[model samples]
Each structure stands twice: as C-alpha cells, then as structure tokens.
Target: MADNLNADLSCPICIDFFTEPVSLECGHSFCRDCILNASRAQGEPTGSIACPQCRQNTARLAIRSNRLLANIVEGFQRLWQPQPAGSGATPAQCQLHQQELRLFCSEDLQLICRLCWSSDAHSQHSCTAIKSAYTACKANSIQLLQKKLNEYRDTHTATGLKISETLEHTNRLQEQMAAEFAELQHFLQQRERALVQRLRAVAESAVNQLVENMALISERCVLIEQALEEIQSTQEQTQFLREIKGILQRCDLQTKPALKTPELHLGEFNGPLQYTVWKQMLNIISPAPVPLTLDSESASLDLVLSKDQTMVKGRSKLKEFSHHAKRFSNYGCVLAREGFTTGKHYWEVNVESIDEWIIGAVKESIDRHSAFALTPSNGLWTLRKWNGNIYGPHHATESECCQNMNLQKVGVCVDYEGGQVSFYNADDMTHLYTSTDRFTEKIYPFFLPFPETMTKGVLKLFHLQL
Candidate 1:
C-alpha cells in the first residue's frame, strides 16, 4: 500500500510527490519548477518557446498552473494517508462485504474489495493496488487530453473556413441563376410580341386582297346596270344588241382572282429546357471587368508608363519621372495604380516582348531594397520566370527549366478577402500557379517583367473579364 501510494504521488522529475504541477503545451506535465528549468535550457530561434517533452513551439511566455490536477493529487494523498490505529472510526470498507476495498481494476476503473476480487466478475481481471492504478491513469490521461485539445482547435478552425466558403459559393450561384432566368424571360417576351404581330399581318393581307376583288366586281355590276337601263330606255334592238355583244366578248373565260393569304412564318420556341438556356447563357452573358488604371507613382524607374497608364514598356526612353517613396528601387517591380482591398477581380497581362518576369499580387508594404527572396513569407505571392525556367511560389522543385517553355501572355486572378491569387496562360488559360496569402493590407497587381534591355520585354496591363 505504501509503495503504491509513493508511486502515484511521485513527480517524474523529482521522483517524489508533486510540488505544484504545471502543464506544458505538449500534453506533458511536470513539477512547475522542473518544466521551467527545461524550457530555459534551450531557446527557440523563431522566438516561440518549445515544450521540453514533445518539442511543440508556442509564443506563450509562461504556462499556467494545473489547478484541477493539483486538487486531485491532494485528494489522492489524503486517501492514501494512514490514520492512527483506533483513533479514526475506520478506513473505507465495501458496503456489501463490510471489508476494506483495496484492489483496483484498470479496465473497470473501479476499486474492488478483497472478497469481490475473487468473484466471477473480477477473477479474470487484472487488478493492482488502488494507488498504482490511479497514478498510471493520471500520467497517461493528462498527455492524451492535451493532444485532443490541440486537435480540436485545428479542426474547428478548418471547419469554420470551409463553412464560410461554401455559403459564399451558394450565394453566388443563386445570383447567377437569377440573372440568367431574368434574361431568358425578357427574350421570350420579345419573341412572342414579334410572332403575334406577324400573325395579325397575315390576317390583314388576306382581308385586303378580298376587298380589292370585291371592289372590281362592284364596278362591273355598275356597268352592267347602266347597260340594262340603256337597253330599256333606248327601245332600240340594234343598240342593245351592240352593247350585249361587247359585254359577252369581254366576259368570256374570265374568273375572279383567288384571295391570297400572307405566308407568315412564326418563330418556334426551341428548348432543351432551362439547362440548355443556362449552358448557353454562360457563353452569351459576359460580365464586364471592373475598370482600373495604373498608378505611375508606384512604377519602377526602369519602366515607362503609357499616357493612359494602362500600358507600360521596358524600352521607352521617356524623361525620368519624379521620385517617390512608394516607387520600387531595387527589384524591377511595379505595382498597379489601383489597389484592391476586397472582392474577386480578374485581369490579364500581355507579356509580348518579355522573356523573364515575376508577376502576382504584392503586399502594399513590400520591402523595396531587401535582397531577401521574393517569397510569400516576405509578403510576395508571385509566379516568376528567370532565364528559361518557370517557377511557382510553393516549392523549390516546382519549376520547369525546359528550353521550349512557351509563356506568351499571362492571366492574373485575385480573390482578396479569400486570400488567394491564381495565374494562368492567357492564351489557353492553362493554370500556371496559385498562391495562398497572409494578407493584412491592401494588395495590388504587382509586375516585375524584365527591363526593355532584356529581350525587348514589355509588360502591358489589360482587363480581361469573366
């Protein structure tokens, strides 16, 4: 009993009972003084402190005391303490047997009186002194708990991001459907009106043709009536006979003209159904790009800004523009005149004369003179090409150094709030690279095409919308 109690209450470092236990981020617990000494033994290069047990890094300066653990240790100590013989009433005794409950079953996690240990339920179970089981359980449980907590935190964050993106996608889909449906309805109405007008014209043409025939018949009837009056009033057989002969000759083999109906062809309602419209709508409905122009102030000295600032070239020998702090000094990088703080924007770049370039979204405050690698860690999310190699921002080996690396034009797509930028070949829209961001400020479309002296390179900004 005494040995089990000693082991349960012992601190791993001191090999004695715990004296103010503290928890480390790695799920390992130790005496408060012991863990602190271990942390100070080694320093983190990145300024984040690392746990001595698992080596997990964190920025916390000091760890909090495990108060609940301390209380449990105290309770176990009291439970194991020996009472003066006959001075206290008694130690814990099992209710059924009135015998002391001594053995602990690790699997059942319960104390068993001596009589119960020999019973059918406990005979095959592994049992040890209660104190030994308690100590072992606490040792493994604390570490397990810390691991679970860390896992939960990461899972929660990832789940939250997924939910947000999914909801946004749903909303965007709804808006697209609404717009397409409205357009389809408007189109159907115009076609229906046109068909109805054509049907009325057919009826009108048929009625007009019949009316003209009737007018001609009425004129002949008037002539016949005049001839009959002349026959009755003249009272001369020879005059009547002459008129009748002329009428008979004119009427021979002649018939009324047939009424001609207008051959009106009404437009048909072609349908594969809504799906067909939706599919066709994608090709017909082109959304306009958000209008933006370049900011010459942010242009690098080696670059020349066009009069409208929408185009820039490396070859122009324009007079040097006034200097500004925002201008890039070291790298041949230039920022767009306008910066995007939020929303989705897409634009295309004409890389006609450029053989080497680095283009993507640049942080608003990128270091101009730092020789540091232009990586995402340094606030640059770029897809770069040097000599003949095309490189992505993610991995060192994620590059193609082939001789026939065809890169004529490039497309830049930015999702500001989503913290992503994707680049593609403008001609075929073959995906080139995509980067995740850690953006905290407004970002602009950054350009770093080779200067005009380098292969007559020219980087022109043009808006290509979806």
Candidate 2:
C-alpha cells in the first residue's frame, strides 16, 4: 500500500514519478534547474537560463503557470496523503448537483446515479453503463464535424472551377468583339473614300456645264453688237440719200427755165446703206438655233416607228400631175371593196361626185352611212393622209368575192381626212384592225409593179387588175 501510494505521487511539471526530475524550457522543474541554469549562463547570453528538457530559452520572457497540470498534481498529492480510519467508501458525487452519483459512463455521454435516473431532467435522456455515453457522444460529434468540413471543401473547389471557366469565356468574347470592331471601322473608311470621290466628280461636272453656258452667252452677245453697228451705218447712209434728193429738186426747178428742161436723171439708189439695214433687221428676227444636246448613251429604242413608203397627193389638173414622176396610174374607176392589201400598192383620186366614201376595211359596203358617223366604225372618214400595213392572210369565207378564192390576199387602205388606217383580209373583205393617228402632210407611197402589164397613161386611160 505504501508503494502504491508512492507510484501515484507525480511531479508537478512532468506529471509522472519524481525520479530524475528536470526543468522544461518554461523554467518549471523538479530537481534539474541548478545544473540547467548553470550550463545556460556559462555560454550564449550571460542571463540565458534555458531549461535542459524542453530547450526553451527562459531569458526573454517569464514562464507561465500550468494551472490544469498543477491542479491535477495537487489532487494526486491529496489522494496520496494520509486519511482517517473508518471512512466508508465515499460515493462519487456530481459537481453540479452536490448529490452522490451511483452511475457514470464516460464513453456513453451519460452520468446518471440512481437519483438522477429518477429525476425529470434525466428521465428521457439515454443512459448507458458507467463511462460509455461520454465516449460515444464525443466520437459522433467528431464524425459530424469531419463530414461538414469535407462538404465545405468540395463546395469551395467546385465554385473556384466555375469562376475560372467564366473568366476564360469572358476573355474570348472580349477579343472577338475587338476584332469585329476593327474590321467594321476599316469597311466604313473605304465607303467614305468612295463617296468622297463620287462627290468630287459631280462637282467638277457642274462647273464644266456652267463654263459652257457662259461661253454660249458671250458668243450671242458678240453677234448682237455686230448687228447694232450695222444698223447705225445704215442710218447714216439714209440721211445722205435725203440730202441728195433735196439738191436734185432745186436743180430741176432752176434748169427748167434754161432750155429743153434737162430731165433730172435719178440714178439707181443701190448702196451699202440698204444692205446693212436689211442684214441688221434679219439678225433681230431670225430664230435661235436649237441645241441637240441629247445624251445618246442613255437613249432607248423601244417605241420607234418603222420606216415605210412616203405618199403625196395631186392638187387639181391632171396636166399638173405630169410634173411629178410617173409612179402609178389611178384608173378613174372606183371599186366598192374593203380589205387589207398584201403586197405594197398606191393610188390617189379626186372626188368628181359627191358620194358617201366608205374608205376603211369592212365586211361589206353597207348603205348605212349614218352608222359610219361614229369614230371607230366600218366607214371611217379620211381626215388626213395615213399609212397602213396588212399581215399575212390565212382564210376568208365570208364575202361573195372571196368565197372560194385564194386565201393569201390582204389589203391596206389609208385615209387622210378621217385620220384612219385599216387592215383587212382582202379575199373575204374581213376587216382585221384599224388605227386613228394620220399623216396629213404630203408623202410618196410605195408600189410593187406587176410583170404582166406595163400600160400607163393619164386618168382617162389606165390599167385595172380586177
């Protein structure tokens, strides 16, 4: 029992048996402070009192007291001290309640004496064998803390990766935007240069047009000044002519009394005065020349009329017609026909009788001249000279003259007064189309000659085909 008591008694610093006690780096020791202090003071700093066990230099700072270790040491010392006899086994007591405890399990987190288990505070709490609940609660708490720490570390790692990816994507997009902006700026500069060039060209053209117009005006002014000078010289010559006429009259009266009254010879008044006056008047009255400044580069030819033969009319007498080239003979005989001409033909006539002239292409010569008063009817008036054309003929089955005749027959009839031209299938007198615009001015018509007959004479005697 004495040996057991000695084994439990421990040093305050090392918390073990006090067998070779040595001081620590903190200067607290059992039996080695003298040798350690002596060794430390001999070398390095004179006041260096480093402990031999912990190797701490105790010269700079004071040693701190180990309260927990001191308390445990004091408790162990009290337990080793002598006690009175007949002390019955003192029950373990709870520090909080000051009551004797019958059970305690350090491993199970439970401290329940019989009295505590019966109390309301500990009735629902888990209670195990002595010292078991405390160990279990500590182990469970450590596991829970470790799980939470691992989860926080994983979350932080994932967030860091996402931030890095987003930063990389932002950097790429910024670079792309900068490159696109540079290309756009280059394109805009090129367009600006082209526009400036075009504007300069337009300005130069405008200046050139202005210069041309001014030059034309200057030439016109010079012509006007020349005209004015001519007119002034003509006026001076007219004044001289008047003075000479007065002198001639005085000589005639004075010489009449002298003899066989010499006749006053009035020489012809031909002079530059008359010519200058005439030229100046002509310059003032003549029409200015028209500028044919058409920009032919842009002209189009979509609606131009095709060139055909010209036609002219005779005035009155048949003898007067002989002066023109003998083109064709108008055989004085009129036909009651209406159709388009296939080949080119020309003829003219003077109306000797006042008859209703149904000149345009029609199905038949109807006696209904009253219905022809309308503008676009069967019987159209010839208000002015006109030219017409007939397309190729195909079939004709209507009129009697074209019932079974050759189908390749067409005719074109022109009228001057009515402003009308018509096309027809001459075999059946079937009118096809008509036009209203006329050619009133004189024009020579074209004619295709037949090889069968060449007889030609005045209007009294001429050749006929049908």
Candidate 3:
C-alpha cells in the first residue's frame, strides 16, 4: 500500500518524489524546475510549454504549483528509508519514491518504477521487464566471448604448427651444414696430398741429375791421372806426346760446365696460399643456380612451350590451353613455375638474338588480364631487346636506352630480401642492369620470347654458375 501511494507522489521526469510539484493545463504534474528545463530543451518559439505526460501544448508557461502533491511527497520522504540488500523482510525500492523498480528503460538503460515508465520523460521510450533485458544482454555478451574464444584456439593451433615447422627446418639446415663442411675438408686434403707429391718428385729429379754429373767427373779424374802417370813413365816420348793432345781435348770437353742443378718450379704454391686455394675452390664451390622452367598455366595464348617446359616461343595459332586465372591474357608473357619470397635466386635464359624479347623478375601479383609495360612501376624489372639492334630497360614512358651488345643470353638474379633484381650477360657474367626497388610479395621469373609482330623466336632456361 505504501509503494502504491509513493508511486502516485513521484515526479516522472526525475523518477523521484515530487518537489515543488507543478501541474500543466493537461492535468499531469512535474517538478517546476524539471518542466522548465524540458521546455527550454524543446526550444519551441511560440512561448508555449508542452505537458510532460500528455504532450499537449499550453498557451503560456503557466506552471501552477501543487501544494497537495508536495505535502504528500514530504510525508512519504519522512517515512521512507532505502531498503538494505538481502533484508528478507522488504523488497528493493526506488530511492526517491520508495516504489519497486520493475522496468528497464531501453533508451536510458536504467531501471524505473511503473509510474516512472508512464511519466512524460519515458512515455515515448521503450521499456522492458528487467529479467527479459538481462537474458538478452547476457546472451549477446556470451556470443561475443565465444567467438573470441574460438579464434584464440585456432591461433594456438597454428602457432604450434609453426613451431614444429621451424624445428624441422632447423634440423635440415644443420645436416646440410655438416655435409658441406665435410666436403670442403675432403677437397683440402686432396689438394694437400697432390702438392706434396709434386714437390717430392721435383726434389728426386734434381738429386738424380747431380749424381750423374758427379759420376762423370770421377771418370774424368781417373783418365787424367792415368795420363799423368803415363807421361811420368815416358819410356817413349812420341807415344806420350800423341796421347797428351787427345787427353787434353777430352778433359776440356768433359769439364765444359757440369749441368746446373735443375731448378724446382714451385708454380702456384709460391703465391699467396689462401688466395690460390680460394681461386681453385671457386670452380668447385659456386652456388648452384636456381632451377626454373616455364609455367604453362601462366603462358600467353600465343606462346608455345617446349615439352620439357624449359623453353618458350611464340606461335601465330592460339594454343588450346585451359582458361586459368594466372594466364597472361593481353601480353605475350610467361612466368617460371617457381616463385621466391626470400633468399637470392639466379637463373639464365638464352634469348638467342630474339629481336623482341624480355627477361626479368616480376611480382606474383601483376595483372594478368591487362596489358602494361615491363617496367619497375608495373612490377616488372626487365631488360628488353627490340628491333634486333636496340637494347634497353623497359619503362612506362620511354625505354632507358643501353648500348647494344648483341646480348644472346641473359642472367636474372633476384635478391628478394635485398629488394634488388640484377641482369647479367650470361656469357661472361657481366652486369647489364640492376633494378633496386621495394619488394613486399613473392616474385616470379618473367619471360617474353617474342612480341606480337614476329612469332618465331625462342627463349631457353638453364642453370649456371653464379
């Protein structure tokens, strides 16, 4: 009974017991200050105020104070004290009117008593039972939490897989390092043994030559001694004199410069030891070039690929190939099967005097259906040979002219992490051009054997020493 009376005494605007209560012409009442504030918020220019409960406009801002309602609210306030939580004897009540909070205002997102819901402030606002609002809001919160939980679980699983992959890669890399070191050791041992053997052979040959010279000198000495003794015994002067001339001539011939000891040719061993070894090791230890082949799926319709996929050429008749999203539709181009996202890679192409050809590295995301110049801006870091004698790096506005060198083979080296694509004359590994640009995605080897004008040139792919 107290709750019912308290509700009747409360002002709808403030959801509290009326203070200085005032009634509008519509017979519904509100605190005088509350109604004035609401009127100013409405900003009506007619000098009229709208009743908070009925929305009826009054001609003047005449708010008549209700002494009866104010007196009742004062008495209610004197008797009402906030009910404590968990006090099993009494229910929770509004602080102002001491009425039970029954409904939730959807707009204000707060609890309100029955009278507060019917008040002018909330008459136009939607209200729902507290239990219904709690159930709906809790379901939404749980749904969001569940979605995040699933996402976190998926991330955890993916991280585990990545960890496993890293371990496998690490093991493989260690094994490769061990194998390479063993091979290097073997090469060094073989070289050392060969050098020692060669040195020993040289020493033995020199000793043998000296021994032969010594034996001849000993023989000459014996002959001269015999001749001297024969002269000394001189029983017959003429025989002695005849033998002396021959002996003298023989001595001169034998003594004529004993062969100089053969000089030992140290050859390469006499030079810088580490430098010589390094020079020799280059032939055996150069990095193996990246193996690349034309991707038939990415070839233009007018291009023909060889059976091994290592060579490509242009053909007038369109090939009967399947429609692929990556196929070059508007350009006579093809990409290698392999794409690189990291590390340095090198591959060679034999253009073989192709009048219209392009060789380079292109981003994997380049447009396939639209035509664009093979330029850096277009994701193609390429060198082109056109009109049979002209060579240049392709650009959108104009090709940067390069001195024609009749380049037949081109080497493309892409350092993905370094963001550089270098072109070389494959015949001598001469640097032809290098394009330095930012790379954020996978890059593929690009090739265009022949343009639309002539369709008979071929380009070949091969691995070479870098």
Candidate 4:
C-alpha cells in the first residue's frame, strides 16, 4: 500500500515525490521545474504549452498548485521514518481477547494472552512465560551461529592450505618446463652444427674438383702456346710438324671430360624448415599416443570386434563366444586390452557419422555384468553422444561441457597422477570437456556403440603416425 501511495504521489516527469507540485488542465501532475522544462522543450511561448502526458495544449499560467498531494507525500515520508533510540517497541497483543500476550503456547507455537491460556482452546497445551521463551530462543540462535562460524573458519583454513599447495605445484611445473626446453635447445644446436658441417664438406669437395680442372687447363694452354711458337719460329718443316702432333695430342687429353661439379642438395633444409624440424622432434618427445586395441574378451555379446581389435560395431545378431567374466553382459561396452595404473596416455577414436557412442575411461574393477551409470562415482569418466546431443559426466549437456565446436574424431587423454581425463575434437585438437578424479586403480579405455539395433556406424581406433 505504501509503495502504491508513493507511486501515486510521484511526478510523472521526475519519477520522484512531487517538488512544488502543480497540475495541468489535462489532469496530469508534475513538479514545477519539470513542467517549466517541458514548456521550453516544446519551443513555444510561455503563455501556452503542451501537456507532456496528454499532448494537449494548455496555458502555462493555468497550472494550479496541488496542495493536498504535497501534504500527503510529506505525511507518508514521516510515517515510515525510524523512531528515535530508547523508544520502547510495541508488545504483541491477543486480537480476540484484547489483552497483552504474555504467555506462550507450545502446541500452537504462538503467543497468547493470560485469559486465552486458561481457555479450553489452549487448556491442554503446555504454556510458558514469554520472557523464558525469548531467552531460550536467543540461546539457540547463538549456538547455531557459533556452529556455522566454526565451520566457515575451518573451510577458510583449508582453502589457504590448498592455495599454498597449488603454488608449490606450479613452481615445480615451471622448473620442469625450463629443463625440458633446455634439452630441446641443446638438441637443436647439435643438429644445426651437424647440418652446417655436412654442407661445408660438400662445398669444399666441389671447389677442389674445379681447382684441379683449372690447373689442367692452364698446363694445356702453356703447351699450346709453345706449339704455336714452334710452328711460327721453326725453319725446319719436319721439326715443326713433329711438335704440332705432340701439341694436338696434349690438347685432346685436356679436352677429355673433367669431373662433373659435385651436386649439393639441401634435402629438407631448404624450405618449410620449422615444420620439418617439428616432425623430427616428435621422435624425441615423450608420452606419445598409446596404441589402444579393444579387448575381444571384454566386449558385449551384442557387439562385434574387427580382426585387429581396433574397430568395434554393433552386431545384427548375437555371436556365440566363450563366456568371460570380464565381458560387459548388459551394456554394449568394450574395454581396451591395455590398462594404465600410472603416467599419462592419449588416444583417439574415429566417431565420424556415429550418432550414439560413449568413449572414455573406466575403472578396471568395475562390475561388468550390470548396467552402470556413466559417472565418476560409478567408476566411469566419459563423454557420451546420445540422441544427437553430447553429454559429459553426470549427464551434463554439451553446453555444460563447454563444447563450442564440431566433433569428428574424438581424442581422449588421461593423466593418472594428475587425476584428469580430457576429451577433444581430434580433427582440430579443440578441447571438449575434462573430468578430474583421484583414481585408485588401473583404468582402461572403453567404448560403447550404443542402441544395440539403431546405430550402424563403427568406432575405429585412430593410430597416431608420430
């Protein structure tokens, strides 16, 4: 009621309690300054102006002061103002009995007057002095607040410890990164020296061959010059003829093919230099992709495995196989043959055109015969695509998993010690989701072709060339 009354008293233009309130002939009210501004905004004469609310022309001087509304607004303001300190608060009273409520009714959880406490309405109910009830209520509130305060303080201390632990871990990672980069730099330096030396050795051999050819030509030229001089200066025709024959033979020997210039090839050092080096660097890098193959013994009867065990597809008809306790009897799920208890491992699965599939890691010891929920608490950390929608752990949707890109092939990476399992779009290496958990035992890669009869696409393990 107060809010409505306040809204009624407020000026339409100023949106506040009217200051020097005035009313136009159109029945709309506004502050004196607000109406004056509106009149000027209309760019009309002061004697005549349009009413801002109704857009009807009216004489500015005809506006009347609203004394009643001004008084009501002032009274409403004072009514809600807080009373001065030491002013006693009003005590509760029984509406029916019209008496001070000094008794408490335990059964009704209400305050009652003395007369009502004795009446049949509350005769069987336990009653206590309101003063005693107030004391007990205050004590309980204090106790509850203390308990919450202790809990919050303990949480604060634990958070501080976590912060310290994270900082220490970050420092260790920095040291490791620096050491690894130093090793790469050393390798690059040695490779550079070896390549440069090889090039220099080829250049020297080519230059030496060219120098030998030049020396032989110089000797032949000297012989030819001597032969020319003997032919021109000789008085005996027989001697000149003999020397000419020897000179011609010398020229023929010099004309014989000299060693071809040694071909110098840069091989991979010419262009796309960085890419070539990076490809070679893969040979030295650790934690390469794991070679994961589906375990045929662990596959469900409704699923079929390829000869290489790298692909799995739903079976049109159930296949007869030796009963294995490790096989998933309920769900069309298959565990990888290799399991990891420690260290980081990465692998990719071709999920292209596959509508429904579940790919991730599962605990080695999880129940194989029963259908289990895809969640960390159930010993499964997985990303699933079902009914055209992708889901992460706990059935969270694709948006919740922060999947902002298309997925073709799916990449799964697990860091056992770091307690993290991450999924990605293998085509572009875009991260899709990550789940963290403290793993206690061996975990194996798992795949599900899903919907026994509906899905037709096969899930193939992608082999990494690096």
Preferred candidate (lDDT higher): 3 or 4: 4
Q: Specify the highest-TM-score model's number.
A: 4
Candidate 3 global CA lDDT score: 0.77
Q: Mind giving the per-residue lDDT tens digits that candidate 1 earns over 310-361?
A: 7767755546667788877787667887787877777778776777788888
Q: What are the per-residue Cα lDDT tens digits for candidate 4 across 276-374? A: 777777776666667788899899888888999998888887767899999888888899999999988999999875777889999988999877777
Report lDDT per candidate.
0.70, 0.40, 0.77, 0.80
Please identify which of the two predictions, 1 or 3, would achieve the higher lDDT against the true structure.
Answer: 3
If the candidates were sorted by their TM-score against the true structure, best first, what order would they fall in? 4, 3, 1, 2
Weakest 10 consecutive residues of candidate 2 by summed lDDT: 297-306
Best by lDDT: 4
Runs with alpha carbons beyond 4 Å of true place in candidate 3: 1-19, 25-29, 51-54, 58-62, 66-193, 211-239, 242-283, 289-345, 348-367, 370-444, 447-466
Over 69-123, each residue of candidate 2 has an lDDT whose tens digit, in order, gives: 5555466646764455787657578776675464443334556554454355654
Q: Give all TM-scores, in the order shown.
A: 0.46, 0.25, 0.46, 0.68
- Please list the residue runs of candidate 2 whose C-alpha ends up more than 4 Å from where it truly belongs after superposition: 1-140, 176-200, 222-235, 238-466
Clashing pairs counted in every model: 2, 42, 0, 0
RMSD (Cα, Å) of candidate 2?
Answer: 43.5
Residue-level error in angstroms, candidate 2, position 138: 4.4
Q: RMSD of candidate 4 to the true fold?
A: 20.4
